[model samples]
Target chain A: MQWLHAVPWDLLLIQTINGIVTGMILALVASGLTLIFGIMDVVNFAHGEFLMLGAYIAVLTIVATHNFWLALIIASLGTGLIGALVYVTTLRPLLGRDPLTTILATFGVSLVLQNYALWQFGPVARKIPEPFSGSITLFHLDYSLYRLMIAGLSAAIIGGFWLFLKFGTWGIWIRATTQDRIMAQAMGIPVPWVLAGVFAIGSAMAGASGVLFGPLVGVDHAMGFDWILRAFIVVVVGGMGSLGGSVLAAIFISLLEAYSSLWVSPAQAGIISFVVLILTLLFRPTGLFVATPK
Target chain B: MTLKDLDKGQVTRRRVLAASGIGLGAAVLSPMPLRYALAQSKPYRIGSEQPLTGVAALGGKTALVGLQMAVDRINKAGGILGRAVELIVADDESKPDSGRRKVEKLVTEDNIDAHVGGYLSNICLACVPVFTENQVVNMISVCLDTTLTTSKCNKYTFRPYDFAPSQAKAFAPHLVNKMGKRWFIAYADYSWGQSTRDAYANEIKGNGGSVVGTLGIPLGTADMTPFLSKISGDFDGLFLIFFGPDSINFVNQGTDLGLRKKYKWAGDGAVAVASQLPALGDKIEGFVGVDRYVPVFDPPLDTPYLHAFYDEAVERLKKAGLENAAPDRYVQSNFEAMNALKLGIEKSKFQGRADSEKLIAALEGLEMKESADFPTGDKLLRKEDHQAFVRETIFEMREGKYHLLDTIPWQKSEVPPACTFA
Candidate 1:
């Protein structure tokens, strides 16, 4: 009871806000990963490298253009092209082969991308230009303006994506292909082009999130590995191929991290994602929000 | 045998007979022994291994530059013991198992006489037992875990720079006496961080100061807001033990959140590294830290030897076309360790393990005075634990540069007493 009274309420409030912002950015990255996996049935081990490339593009573009918003768009488009190139040159040929082969190929591609980034940018970490700096007081609580802006931008993009998936023509085609590729092909849909489009869209989302996170954590060749791991965990705990589940699981994981660090040490909090992942596998293999196929 | 015959490239009977007679005489004299003797007189090799890839690649490359600079100088001075010095380098990629395997190969197959390595603590710890088993003289350059010199110290290993305990001890008195008595600590959650936290806590207690709070931050933590929000109070200063990229993130975020205005800051030398100063800009101004070396220092402490070495190192880096190369603490520590190794080998006339015992004996309790080699002034190699005691500085960052505030002369520690070497 005494320890309960000793809790810092103000600190708790700030961490809760931080947790939401973290989850929002995570969902932005995880959405692309889950979408690609759902449609193509190919797990991208190099998805994190796409994020790293996006960060580098953002930083370089900002340095050249001196406009954060323009840099973000250019970086997204640039990474999308690279993602499409990867699919056409490497992944397209591996279609109809064993899934394990594609997995190993992507893993190899991850190593190559990491080393290329190291060679191109050198080992020093860098930061993207801040769209906005400092903090804002909301409801008498101080929150970082950069974080809040990122959260808002992420929500808008995610919401827009959800709307497209629900009503857009290309979105309907992608959904139909994801459900039944053979039937979609028989229905006169270009399955290969749809798969390529899905991969490009997913990579573009990852790139945008990476650029957004650049100001918060800085950019390094190794940053993608950590982000991709967390994104994978989010997608797994949310149930693969389930968009709504991804958002919930991402927020849940972020909250677990925030509160766990408040109560336990930060070191222990780092393992919470893996711990939740193991527990979910042991008990409910389909995840909390995942729907069962009847 | 005539000059005209040789020029014409003609093999006359007389020329052939004369050449055969000379060759037979030379063979009979048995020149094979002389050829073998010359082959055996090759330069002594020092195998240098560090993670040249992965996250720790920058530090490893910087340390290698320092070692290479020392090697070039020693070779130019007509070598040591009439034998030129050679440095062979390998990358461990920041993996402990990789470090062990590389060191084993260097010692067994490459026939390297001695070794100097390992930028990260875990990698250094992994190579310790291998060095012990092989009886190879190992010079530690960068890793700062105290256990390497105390509980884990071996007859074959020597640490030439300040460890975690000594660094914390040197900084504690300044924080308690001048700054204030109440302190907060934010340390990385690992062996290096744990040891630093323990050392500072003990020192603070010993000096009548009290720790208000302590937070164990995970390494590579991208977000520091949650951790920083928890720290609130009247603590005079915050002690940071984070390193590399994490240090940059913490300082940038912590300052933005008004923690910089609230408290004085102190930490390891990573806080004011040259590479990070531009990114951090004026955010880390007024920060103080304890370090092995700094390129800029107070006028009084600037010895002529220090200036000459710094100038030469900078020139060498420029000549090699390395833009980011600067003589930071990591470079200086490795440079100093290489100099110590050179002195030990020359004094003992080292050949191999059979002669390494003598080299180790020669280095024990060796005091080096201020000279071209000993740029940091007088240093003592403590006979007890084989750790060098050198002068350390407490400097404050002002105007985007580190200005030395105070100096602790001949800083020594036997904090857990001497290693048993059991």
Candidate 2:
């Protein structure tokens, strides 16, 4: 009771809200990663680079058209196209090879993308103009409206994805491929096309997340490095292949990070996620929402 | 037959005599003049090594710009020591080992008289040994780690900017008196961060303030919520010791969590970029940070040279389509350093690398005041430490921009007695 009273309630509430916003962004990134890994059994090390490309595309689109919504759409689609191209050109050759080989190939691709970005954009940070400006006041707390919008939009996108996966024809094929790739291929399903489609969809999701994140995080060549580790943690803790698990884990980790900083130091908050990750592996090795292998 | 033979022989003899006389005349005229001309026009080479493709590329690129600008200016003003100064540039890619190898190449292969541009402290540390071994003067523009001057100090390397310890000493008293007495320090867990924290803590404690807590975050930390929650309300101030993207994340997350509103925020290097304020918008307002450069200098002494530099930087940025990019003080510092190096070269009348060692000795003892560009005062290059004593400008971000709040001058008497050079 004393500890509860000792807590700064207003600050705690503000941090909690901030945590949820950060969690939503994390979930959006992890959802795509988990789906890709679950369906294709490929760890796209250049996933973050795809996000960077998306943000750059968004910036270019906005500059060319002056329509933010159009930029978001184009950026996501553009990243999807790039992802498809990567699947055909790089991932196709490495599909039946060692997992380490695939990992190394993706790492090489990541380096190439990062260097390309550096050469293209130079070293300066590019700011993404906020689509909506202003703050919403709630119980003496001033929260940015744009951040709240991001959280809401991320939630909606995740919800829509859930519905699509549960009901759509291609989504069924994706689920089948995740469950039994050989069986799905025997049943006249094009396995390669399914993998490529999953990769594209997953990459498009990442791209959308990037567009949404640009205003909050800003766009720089090194921006991908900042979020990729956290995304990995989220996917791992949420159970490697479970989208719902990722969302739950992201929120849980975000909340823990938020509350801990008030009692600890803000710098150590990132460690808490890893600690949770380790604890999850030790206790519930399958994660909070472990999917049964079909 | 006898008449014909006599005519042919006489003709051949006259031709040989004329040819011998002409050859002797040509030899007498060519040798001395060619020797004199060769001696008069030897090219002087200046080498630059920097991280052109990695994390420190922003600073390195700007420093390169300044180096190029200075070289162009010097050449346009009739070259150094009446010899054309040629620049040999190398990209170290932010690796210390790579930087060392590049410096070795610059010294052994390029045969440069002087070297400039070290954007990272680690790279600077790697480069100092090479410069010392080669006995070439190295003018470092961006490395701030104090150990670069202290334990690793050498005769050839000179730091224009104040080191971490000096920065901490200058900032601590002001923060303690003006902001609060209880402080929380947070930074990346690395040699650079550790040294900064140690120096800052000592200064803070010396100024009668207590360090409430300290946390060393790992590099590439994205989430700060957990760490923010741990800070006690008893703490009156937060000192962030981070740079680049980390600073931006910390400040934004700190604000979102209402930490900035709860306590006074202060730090070294984290909020030093002027462009960051506009990017941060309302988040960084009221946040006080210390830097070595401020756009505004005190009145009654504004020079056209300073204006010209600023105007040129703005124009170049605009031409590069960075019109909205914030003018960085670090870039200005690099520009100033390049100018100072040229000034040292002119003063020493250094002919080449042979004269560079003596020129470096002179540079270590040199002091400049009443320069057209530096109106506040000139930085004195202490021979003992090879460190420049320059003023630290303190600024606060207001309305998405930097406003000059104060200046801390670095005089000989102002330095602590414990500070010494071996």
Candidate 3:
């Protein structure tokens, strides 16, 4: 009873909000990575490098234009083009080959991209100035305005992506290609073009994630390494091909991380997330949302 | 003899004249003397391994710049023992295994005469055995774990940087006497952070202050809101035990949360280090912490020796287009370490392994006098631990620059007596 009385309700409320915001931001990045894996059957080991490149592009854009929205557009489109270039140059040849070859090739691409960034930008950390200042008060607790805006914008973008997939011509073509590539080709759909478009869209989302989180996270060459690990955990715990599943998993895991910090050390709290992942793998290999194969 | 006769038959009168001309050319250009040949041969290589790719890459690059400057200065003055010095650098990527491999390559493949490491205690700790096996002198800079100078202390390893316990002990007086008694600690959850937090905790307890709460943050953590939000107890100050970008993220978020406005802040002065402080600008004002060196000390109070070195360093930095290169602890430590190496080599008249042993003996307990090269007054190297004893400065951030508040004289007893080396 005394311990219950010692609880800081305001702090808990703030952390809960933080967890949700972090989850949404993470979902934006993970959704792209999962989408790429689902449609192409090719795991992009360089997905984290794309995020890093996006952050760097955002840094340049913000410094030059001083407009966050312009930075986002340029960063996303720039990174999207780079992603398509990577697929054409590296991934296309190995598409029908052994998956191991493609995986190693992507890993090599990751190293090249990381070292290239290191060479070009050096290792210093640069922060994107927050467009807005101060915090918004909700439930008598003040939350950072930039963080709240990121959450709101991330939710909107993710919602917009779902609607696009449901109605847009290119989005429908991408889905058809993903469901059955040979059949989609038989239906006179250009499978290769649709696949390329999906990859571009996925890469764009990852780029936008980087730009949105840049002000909060501090942009650096290796900033994407840790985020990519969390993104992987999110996709794994969610059904790999399921869009709704990844978002839900990200939120669930982030909430656990936030609430656990109140009781245990942050490192230990991180371990708890991995534990949940391992337990999910053991009990249901296909994840929470994926139906067990007969 | 038959073959020589056959070759002689092929040498005609024109060939003889041509051979004579070639001999003159060779004498004039190529084979001047054995001395010239030795001069153009291998230089005295000093190897350095640092995190050139990962999160701590900024610190690594800064330390390398300081080392390169020191080498250039030494080489300009006819080099060490009249032989030019060469620096062989390898990227460790902030990984201990990579550090070990790089050290092994430096000592074995490059055949480095001496080496230095910057940042990441785990990486430094990993390279310990590599140094021992190769019998190379490793001047460690910016890795603050006390065990390096205590239980893990070795003849091959010498630390020019201040350890965690010494810095904590030096700053304890101000934290307890001036600031309020209650404190909350937020620390990164690695070797350096854990050790630093422990050192501070002991100091606070010994000084009759109590801690209200403590939180551990993982490495590469971008968000600090979860930890900051939980600081609900009645604490007078917040002690941050983080380094590099992690430190930057914490301070930025802590300010946004208005925690800095509410509570007095104290931690490692490295939280506002050279490359990092400029980014934060005025936000770090009013914060105080302990530092190994602060280049902002002015004339009269600061030694003439220090001022002269500062002027030279600033000019060099400007010429290199590093206009923002301020003399933080990392740069100073590596610069000091390079000078100390030169001093040791000159004193002992280095020859080879036997002379390296003699150099180690000469360096142990060496009392360095204040000079243009060593501008930070007198420094002592304790024979038992090979830990450099330099005065610690407590600096407060004022007007976006560090102002030296007080200087703590070196106390031998401040560092715990060493245990036997493994």
Candidate 4:
């Protein structure tokens, strides 16, 4: 009872909001990765590059339009288009080939994009002013309202995407394609186009997350790197190629890291994600949220 | 070239491709130098390793610019001892393994006379033994890990700029007296950060101040919200030791969490480099820092030679796509490091790797005066540690520009030699 009283309940409560806010952003980023992996067996190393390009596009859009919302939309559309182009030019030719080639291709694309950003943007981190400059005090914290907006907006976007998958015509096409590619193709669903569309949708989600999270940190060529790593962990932990499971895992990992920071340093708490990643691989390779395969 | 698109009808793709290939081959086999007028004498090959890609690429890019600037100047002024200073640059890729491999190549394959660049401290530390083993005079550029000149000091390496210990000694008094008594140090959680934290912590305590708590975030961590949330309790100032993107991330996230309002922001001068000012914007305002060189023209720093150096650097940085970027300490150190090597070569009348001992002897206890070459100011490359001490600039960022506060002379900032090179 005395030991329990020693806990800083106020800090714990604050970490809850921090975790959820961070979790939502992670979910948004991971959702795209999981979506791509779900439909296509391609492990996109360049997913982070798309996110960086999204932030860069958002920077350009905001400069021209001065509207954060417009920047988000333009960034998403821009990355989605780029995603389709990449698939058509690069990924499409190597579809039935070994998956390692696609991974390597995306990695090569990542290097090109990262260097391209540096060459074009010139190593300086760009600023994206938050749409709102307000904060709300909670217990012992004065958290940014923009951060809260990020979480809410991320949830809304993810929810909307989920709904689209549930009801939209293309959504059923993607779902059917994911279930059985050959069968869906036999049923007249253009398999190549569906794969391209899925990649575009996933890339669009990643781009949106970038613009949403851009204001919190300086938008640079490598901004997506940290989040993408955690997103991969979440993708693995939530079960690879499973969108719903990935969302849950993103929140789980973010909350786990945040709450653990209450007792351990953030650096040590970060290891919690990797530890869980290893454990999940060892104990439940199908992921914590995934049903054990028969 | 794309500019050679004279006519679409005449310059077809095949013809254009053929012309481009020929031009590329001509440029590669016999590259032209527009700056220097030197004899046909064999050049002094200087090896440089910087992160041309990966996380620290920005700083590494600027560092090469400085190294090139110095080499150009040296060559323009009758080259280094009548031979052109040919700089052989290697992209470290910001990894220790790659850095070690590149340095090994620069030494064994390239057969460089001496080495002139190393941007990241961890890479520098990793590559130290290679230089010592190969008996090359390694002039460190921007790596600020204190151990380079202190605990892990090496015979082959010479740091011709201020280290963390000197900076901490110079800045700690001002921080304790002017800023606040209690501080919380948040560092990049690597060799450089860890050493710099200890240096500042020791200096702060010595100045009758205290470090309340410290946070160590891993390098390249873009989102520090999770770590930064734990840094709330009570602290007068947040002492940061991060550079490049990591610093940008820390300041932005820390400010977003109301940590900026709660605590007085002050840290290394790197937190507000001229290139990063555009990214940091107004968030970095009022942040005070100390550095060996800032792109400022204040009192003692506003020398004619520095202006010359500054003008050239500004022009060159613009050419490198860093528009409006003033030469940071990385540029300054690399420029001076090459210059220091030149003086050593001249002093010893050294020719190549065979004259390594003579070069080392000449460089030991080297005294650099304020000039176009050493624009930062007078420095003493102390014999014991081979670490140069220069005037530390204490400044505040106001309206996205640096305003000088007080200058700490090298003598005032000097810590006793703590190295015995093996």
Q: What is the C-alpha lDDT of each candidate?
A: 0.81, 0.76, 0.80, 0.90
Q: How well does candidate 2 score on lDDT at residue B231? A: 53
Q: Report interface Cα RMSD per prediction.
A: 2.7, 4.0, 2.5, 1.2
lDDT of 4 by residue, A1-294 (tens): 899998988888888888899898999999999999888899999999888989999999999999999999999999999989988998989888899999999999888888899889988789998898988886645788999999999999999998998999999999999999999999999888889999999899989988998887888877878888999999999999888898899889989988899888888899999999999999999888989999
All DockQ scores:
0.40, 0.28, 0.43, 0.59
Candidate 1's C-alpha runs over 4 A off are A1-8, A137-142, B1-40, B315-325, B411-417
- At residue A224, what lDDT does model 3 achieve? 81
Using TM-score as the measure, the top candidate is 4
Fraction of native contacts (fnat) of each candidate: 0.30, 0.28, 0.41, 0.76
RMSD versus native structure for model 3: 5.2
| Candidate 3, B11-119: lDDT as tens digits | 5678778878987777567753643455545577889998877878878877776777788889999888777888999999888888889889999999888887657
Q: Candidate 4, residue B354: CA error in Å? A: 0.8
Over the stretch A219-286, how does candidate 2's per-residue lDDT look in tens digits? 66767776788888888889988999999989999888888777665665657989998987898777
RMSD values for the candidates in order, in angstroms, are 4.3, 6.8, 5.2, 8.4
lDDT of 1: 0.81
**Candidate 4 vs. truth: CA RMSD?**
8.4
lDDT ranking, high to low = 4, 1, 3, 2
Clashing pairs in 3: none
Question: Docking quality tier of candidate 1?
Answer: acceptable
